[model samples]
Target: MPYSPEDKKRAVMRLRRIKGQAAALERAVEEGTDCKSLLQQIAALRGAANGLMAEVLDSHLRELFGSAKETVAVREARDPDEEIEALMKTLRTYLK
Candidate 1:
């Protein structure tokens, strides 16, 4: 269930699109776009970011659980706090 080359390419493309949206957001602010319009753009960017995150999580889940025996072991060893900490660290840069 590992990601294929096509998956990598698609992820890269999505990232590039997100980068462009970020640049557009900057430009909108600089050009004094209406607050509502700016907020809408921001929302769209957030959705895109969330979609990327979902894709990554789905891929990880597939890698960890697609095999029947491994899936059971993973569930038995689940650690919610540890998982949350890992996610927090991974996402901290975005907060800054």
Candidate 2:
């Protein structure tokens, strides 16, 4: 399912923050920031990206399998257990 307006807004805000983090990292590099500080910035950027990915993944899963309001016919078209298992496998491989 597509993101609701609120979700889209939140995602845009997150992406903007990530863009800011990237810009900061670029500036740090140009200014020859210390390795420790650079590493910390990189880590923070990575965490933010991962967090955004996780939030979107959660939203997708909820739309696919957790919505109590979904029609019976819609629910019958997919196997939630199988979908979840596939998603888990993908996540495991991605995280590794």
CA RMSD of each candidate after superposition: 4.6, 2.2
The true-structure Cα RMSD of candidate 2 reads 2.2
Write down the lDDT of every candidate, Cα atoms only: 0.79, 0.87
Where does candidate 1 have its weakest 10-residue lDDT segment? 62-71
- Predicted candidate 1 versus true structure: per-residue lDDT over 9-78, tens digit per residue: 8788889989999999999999999999999999999988988877776786555445565656667687
Assess the local accuracy of residue 73 in candidate 2 as a C-alpha lDDT between 0 and 100.
Answer: 93
Number of backbone clashes in candidate 1: 0
Give the TM-score comparing model 1 with the true structure, all chains together.
0.68
- Candidate 2 is scored at a TM of 0.81
Q: In candidate 2, where is summed lDDT lowest over 10 consecutive residues?
A: 57-66
- Model 2 C-alpha lDDT per residue in residues 46-88, reported as the tens digit of each score: 9999978888888877865768987899889998789889888
Candidate 1, RMSD to the unseen true structure? 4.6
